[model samples]
Target chain A: MRIVVLAGGIGGARFLRGLKAAAPDAEITVIGNTGDDIHLFGLKVCPDLDTVMYTLGGGIHEEQGWGRADESFTVKEELAAYGVGPEWFGLGDRDFATHIVRTQMIDAGYPLSAVTEALCARWRPGVRLIPMSDDRVETHVVIDTPEEGRKAVHFQEYWVRLHASVPAQAILPVGAETAKPAPGVLQAIGEADLVLFPPSNPVVSIGTILAVPGIRAAIAEAGVPVVGLSPIIGGAPVRGMADKVLAAVGVESTAAAVAAHYGSGLLDGWLVDTSDAAAVAEVEAAGIRCRAVPLLMTDVEAAAAMAREALELAEEVR
Target chain B: MRIVVLAGGIGGARFLRGLKAAAPDAEITVIGNTGDDIHLFGLKVCPDLDTVMYTLGGGIHEEQGWGRADESFTVKEELAAYGVGPEWFGLGDRDFATHIVRTQMIDAGYPLSAVTEALCARWRPGVRLIPMSDDRVETHVVIDTPEEGRKAVHFQEYWVRLHASVPAQAILPVGAETAKPAPGVLQAIGEADLVLFPPSNPVVSIGTILAVPGIRAAIAEAGVPVVGLSPIIGGAPVRGMADKVLAAVGVESTAAAVAAHYGSGLLDGWLVDTSDAAAVAEVEAAGIRCRAVPLLMTDVEAAAAMAREALELAEEVR
Candidate 1:
């Protein structure tokens, strides 16, 4: 079976890890979000791309769910000594090397898609990983700072630096309007028998990917099952600042509300956690097939179960 | 009295520290070389600037004479995992932060001089550290590379990676021909009561800074005594690959030979170590005041003594 997954960081990486285990024979293509990519220290840090790469390559700091395992910060301390520190977001020395190589390759005139391929050559994540676009589409949050008022902060500053405490007035994927899908992204969506949105931050994660010019249109036009796992579960986020991000999009933090947000026009199957079983009826009422499954992915086994449920839901929708 | 010193990395930073201790009330300006600057992980890494900052700020690794004390390498490890490493040079995570800020400031249209001023503010190195130029002038070494067969490689790659083992046919500061001194550099030199060149790598360090058009001319024109302590001690470099680099420039690695190379035109006075006292007559024979003193700076006290000797030599020459 041809399976296409649109993903963000941590949760998406974890989910993809399980999906790979559960369906080895299935052709998996991951369209990773690059909006979370930040130019830090003159290097491109694609959080989502790194998460997927590391998680699949078995180099991930499993506990942190981001960056390579056994990372060092010697470079960071040296920088601090030079008094050239932002010091908010952590960039490990090991992690810095990746950004360095990526930046060097990018500077050498290779498009990000080609750079991603070169990076993946070592990871060999067993799935074809494609960036949503080669274009520079940064996810920016418009926040009302005391001094700057409604200033646009880079997604990392909003997420990593501020810890997302400030009210996000609006979230924008800068350059998404002009972004073209990376080489195989649209083709994979069209060729896919099933499309899955893992339990990542809905509004910022998959939403950012969908915001790209051709991506959402391609997925919507694909005459196949489009399944989305509820990132919002049991009236709270399973992980990350999804609730805060959803508030920026004016969506309430609930599974049925989020499912209804994706809507029937784009979604064929919606999988909510069993705890939100009551909301399953409401999601189904939106004309999308809804299943209340055990969606708390505590481990790879649990994640596999969720993937299995999503794939099963896809078969049922078909 | 206001004093400014031209410097490179370790020796320069260490000497500046003593200069601060020797003349505590003097407003010291440091015209640091940016030729050793390398773009690693998307950040501009001014090794000499950082070395000066770290050494003076008490953050330098005492044993290593580079990077921070008690540094960690989580970032490097993480970067390697992501297959993003040349992995030769040690860049700690904290060190990465400095370059990030420098790069950001540079990108934001701040000349390296101003950016350096901002950085030195936090360091409070008691020295106004300014880059010789804001422009990019990379030092490259022409070597018989196995990959390219006698192509020029970055100085860092040649020095750190190849350990300067290969014979350098030529050492060129790329883009230096038209490069001018950064704002404040010439003014700082012109205004100085005295100028001192510490025992830094003569070729890449001081030579590279001098490669910037206005700086060497400014020093030559400055009415104040221009004194340089011998980097060559007893027919060998005090430290570094000076001997290897000197071969490229066709200069002999002797205290007298090096002093003669600088000549009476640029140097008003020169200080040689007690071990090279015999070479003093030869240096003095070249029409410049020369002194032989205990120049091995074992500690801050010793470094201060060296500074005093250089000052005395400058007074004699004047």
Candidate 2:
């Protein structure tokens, strides 16, 4: 099977790990969201890309579902010691190496896509990973600060430093309107047997990927079964501050709302947790086929089962 | 009292600590060699400036004479894991932060001099540290590589990676001719009460600083007594491979020859180690006042005593 997966950070990374297990023989191409990429300490840190790479390559922290296992925060601690900070986004020593290498490559004039490929050379994540856009398309969150009122902060500062405590007025993918899809992104979607949108934050993750100028159009025109799993379970995000960003886009923090937000025009099939079974009718009523499954990825096996259901749903749509 | 000292890495940094102790009330301005400055992994690594800062700030690994105390090499280890590196120059996690901050500031359009000052604010290294040149003037050592034949390797790669094993055919301060003195360097030398050259590597360190267009002329014209301590004691360097580079510049590795190399026109006085007492007469014959003192910095007290001797010799010249 040739599958194209649009991924964000932790949730998408974990889901991809399961997808790999569900279809070991499948050729997977991951279109990693780059809106979350931030230049910290002058190094380009692609959180979503790194998370996906690490999780699938067996280097990810199992407990955290992101970053490297046995990682030390020595670099971050030292940076803090120098009074250089944003001390909130915990870049571990091992993780810092990836950024250092990526930044080095980028500084040497390598595109983000080329740099990602070079990085994946070591990880061998078993998937062709391409960024949504090679151009700068930082996700900025508009939030009300006590001093600055409604000011746009980089998505990282909003999520990491503020803990998304304040209400987000809007989520802006700063350069997406003009961003060309990274090399091979459109081709991956065009040739895919199935396209999966894992339980990543729809607004900032998959939504941001879709916001890039050519990417959304390419996926919609790909002529394949497009499936999505709801990040919301029991009317709250299974993990991460997805609801805060969802509200920024004026979307309700529910499985049915999230599926509807993606909509039938793009998504032919949607999967929700058994707990949100009642929302299945509400989602299917919107012209997209919806299935309620045990969507909680409690373990790799559970995640595999969820992937299997999504694949089966794609077959049903076909 | 105002003092200007031209310094390199470990030896010069150690000597500066002693200079600080010897003349506690003196306003010391350091002209650090940027010829030793290298870009590793796309970050500017100012070894000489960092050594002086860390040594004075009490963060230096005393035993090693460079790098941070109690450092971790997690970042280096991880970089190697990614198959990205020379993996020879041991930049610990703590040290990486310094480079990252410096590179970032430089990229933001801050000159190396301003970046050094900003960094020293945190180190509080006491001395007003300035690079010999704000412009890039990397020391390149021409050596015979087995694969590349005659190639100019960076001084750090020559010293750190090759262990200076290959004979240096030439030690070129690559951009010194076109480079101007860093913001405060010439002014510091011109207005100094005393100017001193610590036992730093002459060819790549002090010599490279002198190679910068106006610096050597400034010291020669400065009204204050210009004194130097012999990096070469007896017939070899007290520490470091100064002999390897001295040979490249066609200078003998002897206190008297080194004193003569600086010339009586620039130097008013020179201090040699007691072991090189016989060479004092030869140095004095070249029309520069010479004194023999214990130059091995066995301890801070010993270093302070050496500094005291250099100061007394400067007074004698005055």
Candidate 3:
């Protein structure tokens, strides 16, 4: 089977790890969200893309679920010592190499997709990984603060630096309106037996991917089972501050609300955690097939089991 | 007394340490060579300027004579793992931070001179450091290989990668003819009470500085004593492969021969190592005042003594 997975950072990477293990024979093509990409120290940093790449390539810090294992902060410390900052974003020496290579290639006129391919040649993430759009599409969050009144900050500053402390008044995927889907994105969606949205932040991760002009339309019409696993369980996010951004978009922090947010038009199947088993009927009533399964990716096996459940649900919807 | 020094990499940096110790109260301005600067991994790597800064700022590796003390090569090793290279040049993690800051500032439309000043704000290397030119002036060595016939390679590739093993048919400071001296370079030379040449490479280091359109004229017409310590100790360079490049310019690698190469019009006094005492008269015959001194900069104290001798010779010429 050919499976197309739309991924964000840690949570998505963990789910994809399970998906790969569950469907070992399937060809996987990952459309990584690049909205979280930021230029730090004049180098391009694609947090989501690198997270997926490192996780799959065995370079990831397993406990943190993002960044390289055994990484050193010498470069970051030196940069800080030089008074060059955004010191909160921890870019390790090993991680800076990825950004440097990516920035160099991008500055040399290679599109981000081509650069991603070249970088993946080293990682060999098993799946063909492509950025959602080669064109720049940064996710910015509008926050109200007493000092600044209200302002739009880069997603990284809002997430990494601010720790999502301040309330997000609005979440904007800047430049998404004009960005064309990267070369393989639409084709992968068209060719896939089923499309899966791993438990990633709907507002800024998968949501930003869908915001690109042609991508949502292509997936909606791909004629394949479009399955989604909820990032929310019970009434809270399983990981990350998904609820904060969810509030910015006015979506309730609940599995059924998230399923309804993706809506029946684009989603054919939705998986909620067993903790939110009560929400399955409400999701099914909204015309999308719904199933409650153990959604926590506690380990590789747990993630693989969730992946199997999603695939089984896709089959049931088909 | 106000002093101006033309400097290169390791040799120049070491000599400056001695100069600083010798002339503790003398207002010293250093016009650093920038032709050796190269873009490595898409970041500006100013070898000579950085060497001067790191050496004086107490960040330089004592044994290696360049780069930061206690440096790690994690960034470099990671870059190599990604197969991104020209790995012969050792850019440690700490060193990469400097390049990143410089490249960012340059990209943001800051001239190299301004960037150098901002960086110096952190290093605070005591002396006012200026590049010979803000405009790019790469030293390219024309070398013949059995495979490629003849090609002009970057100085770094020639010196670091090829180890100057190949004979240089020509040494060209590629952009010097069109390049104007950087701000304060000519002014510093014109305002100086005396100018000193450190035991740096005559061909690529001091030669490249003189190649900047107005700098040589400024020094010559400034009417201050221009004294130089010969890099060639006996019949060879005290350190580094200065002979290979000196030959490219048709200057023999000898203390007396190098003094004649500069000529009396530009040089007022010359200091050769005591071992080359016999050649002092020949240098004097070229109409420049010449002296034989213990020119080996084996330690800071020895370099300081050589600086004192050079200053005393400058007073005699005055």
Candidate 4:
């Protein structure tokens, strides 16, 4: 079986781990979101891509579900000592090497897709990982502050620095309008038997990927079952500040609202947590097939079960 | 009082420390050799400038005479893990931060001189440290290897990787022919009350600085006394493999021969160690005043005495 998964950071990467376990023999292609990519200290950092890469490659800090395991902060501490900062973003020494290599290759004129391929040659993430777009596309969040009034900050500044406590006025994928899908993204979707949208932030993670010119249209027209797992459990995000960003895009923080936001034309099936079983009727009423399952990714086995349910739902939709 | 010093890596940094101790009230401007500056992992590693800066700033590894004290090699270890490396040059985590900040500033359109100044703002190295040239000028050494035949390699590869054991066929300052001295370099030499060449590599270090288009002329035309301390002690360098490069430039590794290589017109005074006292007459006979002093820099105090002797020799020439 050929599977194409659209992934964001932690939540998506964790889900991918379960998906790989659920179907070990299946050929998996991950279309990782690149809107969270930022250049800090002149090193290109793709948080979402790195998260997925580390998670699948067994190098991820298992508890944090993001950065590298056994990491050191000597580089970051030294950078801070030199008064070079955005000290909020914790890029560990081990993780910095990945960014350094990626940036070096990019500076040498290799496109991000080619760089990603080269990086994977070392990690051997067991899946074909490609970014949503090779072109720069930074996600920015507009927020109101008593001091600064209305201003757009990089998604990382909004999410990591501010902790998403402030109300987001708007979320913008700055360069997505002009960005093209990275090489093999559309072809991967077209060739896949099914497409899975892992429980990632709808507004900034999967939403930003869709914002790219060709990606959303290609996924919508792929002629294969398009399944999505809700990042929202009950009315709260399973992980991350997905609800805060969802509000910026005017979507309610509910499994049904998230499904309706993606819409029937684009989504073939949607999976809600067992607690939100009542919302399955509302989601199905909106013309997309819906299933309520125990979607809490408590462990690999539990997550694998969730993946199995999503695939079953995909079969039902087909 | 204004003092100008031409410097290289470890030896020059140690001498500068002594010079600072000897003439604390003097405003010292260091013309750091850029010939040893290299790009490793896409970050500019200015070994000579950093040694001077770190030595003066009290961040240098005292025993090693270069790099940062209490440094961690996490970044280097991680880079090696990624199979990306020269793996020979030891750049610690703290040192990586300096290069990262420098590379970022350079990429943002700041010249190396401005970037060096900005870095110094944090290091507070006391001296006004300027690279010999803002332009890229790498020292290359031609060597004959049984496997590669005759070829030119970067100075770092020749010294660090090969240990400079092979005889250097030629020493070329790759970009020095067209390179202009960095901002404030020529002016510092022109307006100096005194100029001193510390116990640094005569061929690759100070010689590369002189190779720049207008720097040698500025120093020669400066009316103030130009003095130098012999790097060669008795018949060998006190530290480093200066003999290999000295041979490349066809100068015997002797105190008098090095003084004669500078020529009496350029060097007003030359200070040789007391052990090389017999050669003082030969150096003086070439129309330059020569002093025989205890030149062994066993400690900062000893180095300070050497600096004081150079200053006295400058007064004698005046």
Candidate 5:
């Protein structure tokens, strides 16, 4: 089976690990969200892409579920000592090499897709990992502050620096309207046996990918089973502040609400956690097939079981 | 007294430490060589300027004489793992931070002089450190290999990668002919009570700085005592492979020969190592005042003594 997965950072990476283990024989193509990409210290940093790459390649920090294991902060510390900042973003020495190589290649005129492919050559992520769009598409969050009134900060500053303390009045995927889907993205979706949305932030992660002009239309019309696993469980996010940004987009922090947000037109199957088993009936009533499964990715095995369930649900819908 | 010093990398930096200790209250301005600057991994690596900054700022590796103390190579190792390199140049994690800051500032349209000043704000190396030129002036060594015949490679590749093992047929400071001196370079020379040449490479370091259009003229006509300590002692360089490049410029690697190379018009006094005492009379016969002093910078105290001797010689010439 050929599977296409749209991934964000940690939660998405963890789910993809399960998906890979569950369907070992399947050819997987990951369309990694790049909306969280930020240029720090003049180097391109694709948080979601690197998270998936490192996680699948066995170099991820298992506990944090993002960044490299055994990483040092020498570079970041030195940069801070030089008074260069955004000090809240913990970019480690080992992690910085990725950005350095990426920035160098990009400066040398290679597109981000080509650069991603080159970086993946070292990791051998065992799947075709392509960014959602090579064109710059940064997600900016509009926040109302007493000092500044209103301002749109880079998603990283909003998420990593501010820790999403202030409410997001609006979440904008700036430049997504003009960004073409990166090479191989539409083809992968068209060629896949099924498409899966791992438990990633719907508003800014997978949602930003979908916001790209041609991508959402391609996936909706791809003629393959389109399935999604909820990032919410028991009315709370499985990980990350998914609820905060979901509120910005006016989506309720519930599995059924998230499934309905993706909607029946694009989603054929939806998976809710067993803790929110009642959400399945509401989701199914909204015209998409729904199943309640063990959605907490406590470990790879639990995630693999959830992946298997999603695949089974895809089969049932087909 | 106001003093101006022309400096290169390790040797120049070490000599400056001594000068600082010798004349604790002298207003010193250092015009640092920038021809050795190179772009690595899309970041500007200003070896000489950084050497001076780190050395005087108390952050230098005492044994190595360059780079930051307690440096780590995690970023470099990671870059090599990604197969991105010219790995012979050992840029440690701390050093990479300086380059990143410089490259980011340059990209944001800051001239190298302004960037150097901003970086100095952190290091506070006491003396005002200015680059030889804001415009790019890369030193390229023309070398003949059995495979490539005659080719001009970057000076860093020649010095660091090839170890200057190959004979340099020519040393060209590319882009120096039209390059104007950086802001304050000529002004530093013109306003100085005396100018000193540290035992940096005469061909690539001090020579390249002089190649900037207006700097040599300013120093020669400034009417201040221009005293130089010879890098060459006896018949070889005290440290580094200065002979290989000196020979490329058709100058023999001897204390007396180097003084003649600078000439009486530009140099008023010259200091050779006590071992090269015999060359003092020969240098004096050529119209430049010469002295034999213990020039080995084995320690900061020894370097300070040498600086005192050079300053005393400058007074005698005055």
Candidate 6:
């Protein structure tokens, strides 16, 4: 199968790794969301692309879920000695080099998609990793908090800084309306035999990618089976604050509701945790092939199984 | 007194600390060369400015002469994992935060001068540390070598990368003529009662600052003495490679030659090492007051003595 996976950062990276293991023959092309790319300490950091690349490339920090292993910080101390600090986000000294190179290359007139490709060349993250767009598309969250009232915060600030405590009234992917899909993104969708949305965040994860101008339209027009493994396992996010974002988008924090939200127009197949098996009939009633295989993805083996099951469901729908 | 100082990195930072110790009441302004500033790991780093800031603010890595003590490198490891590196320049983990804040501030439409001022608010480096100019003016050295014939290299690549072994033919602070002095730089020179050239590289340090528009003229027309402490001690630089740069600027690396290179119109006074007393007479013949004193500033006490002696020479010239 020529698989095209739309991914966010950590969760999607981890899932892609399993998907690769599950179908070694299946050619995979990952279209990563670039809206979260931030310039910090003069380095251009694409959190999602890095997470996916590292997880697949075998350089990811096992414990941290982000950045690299065996990093140093001599440069960082020198920078701090210069009294340059925000001191909030955890950017390792070694990690800064990646962002630095990315920023430098971009500043030297290369688009971020090309930079990501160049960066991925060294990592050799088996499958092709493409950014959603070269243009800036930052994810901004609107929050009503006591201190700032109704204020917009960058996705990192909302997630890393605020720890997502404040009620997210709305999650807007800024510049998505204007962002063109990166080269080969639409082509991959058009060429795909099957597209699988991993058990990732519905709103900020898959939803953000769909928000990009031509992406959702391309997927809708692709004329292939699109399957998704639900992130809501047993009525809660398998990882991260996927439910928090769901609330922001006014989607009920449930497996069947989320699958139905993707609907028959986009999704031909929907997956659920075994615990949510009771909702399978209801989801199937919505004119989609519904499956109730375990979707927790506790380890790589389990994740591969999930991917395989999703693919199987895609076949069933086709 | 409205005192101005021309300085380089660590050695200069330490001397400035002692200068503050000796002349606490003097309205001291530092004209710091930005030649050593490099873009590493995506962060814009001003090494000399950092050195001055850290040394003055008590955050300096006293043993290493650069970076901060007790630093980390979590981010750097992450970066390397992404396979990004120059790897030679030390970038600490804790230090990355500083660069993040600095880059963020710069991206937010703040000029480097104002950003530096804001950073110094926290570091509180007592002497005003102003960049020679807001515009980039990197020093390049033309070197004649066995392998490359005559090739121009960045000051850092010459000094740090190549170790200054290659005989330098010419030194030029690129873009300096077109580069304007940073706001308040000329004003500081114009208002100075005494301008002291610290024991720093005459070509790359003090010379680069002088290369800026309106700086040298302002110092000359300041209506006060311009006194300089000799970097050349006992016919050699106290530290670093003043001789290599001297070769580039067509000046012999001697107290007398350095004195004559500055000339009478710009310099009112010059201090040399006691061992170079004979050269002091030659300096005096150039119509500039010359003092032979112990110019080896090993510690703050020794540097304070040098500062006191420089101020006294300014007094004598006045």
Off by over 4 Å in 4: none
Deviation from native of the Cα of residue A87 in model 3, angstroms: 0.4
> Which candidate tops lDDT?
3
Write model 4 residue lDDT over B32-141, tens digit each, in one string: 99999999999999999999999999999999988999999988987897899989999998899999999999999999999999999999988999999999999999
True interface contacts retained by model 1? 0.82
Which of the CAPRI classes, incorrect, acceptable, medium or high, describes model 2? high
TM-score of each: 0.89, 0.98, 0.99, 0.98, 0.99, 0.91
Candidate number with the higher lDDT (4 or 5) = 5
Maximum-DockQ candidate: 5
Tens-digit per-residue lDDT, A46-92, candidate 3: 99999999999999999998999999999999989889997999999
lDDT per residue as tens, model 2, A1-318: 999999999999889989999999999999999998999999999999999999988899999887889989887887787799888888999999999999999989999999999999999999999999899999999988789778999999999898899999999999999999999998888899989999999999999999998778788888899999999999999998999999989999999999989988899999999999999999999999999999899999999999999999999997
Candidate 2 residue runs with Cα over 4 Å from true position:
none
lDDT of 2 by residue, B208-273 (tens): 999999989999988789999999987988888999999999999999999999999999999998
Per-candidate alpha-carbon RMSD to the true structure: 3.2, 1.3, 0.7, 1.2, 0.8, 2.9
Better of 1 and 6 by lDDT: 1
lDDT of 5 by residue, A1-318 (tens): 999999999988899889889999999999999999999989999999999999999999999988999999998998899899979999999999999999999999999999999999999988999999999999999999899899999999999888888899999999999999999999999999999999999989999999998889889998889999999999999888989999998999999999999999999999999899988889989999998888889999998998999999999988
lDDT, candidate 1, at B257? 80
Error of 1 at B92 (Å): 3.2
For model 6, what is the C-alpha lDDT against the true structure?
A: 0.83
Error of 1 at A70 (Å): 4.7
Please give me the DockQ of candidate 5 compared with the native complex: 0.94
Error of 5 at A179 (Å): 0.5
lDDT of each: 0.86, 0.93, 0.95, 0.93, 0.94, 0.83
Interface RMSD of each: 3.8, 0.8, 0.5, 0.8, 0.5, 4.9
Clashes of each: 41, 0, 0, 0, 0, 38
Q: Compute the lDDT for candidate 2.
A: 0.93
Please state the Cα-based DockQ of model 1 relative to the true two-chain complex: 0.47
DockQ of each: 0.47, 0.85, 0.93, 0.81, 0.94, 0.43
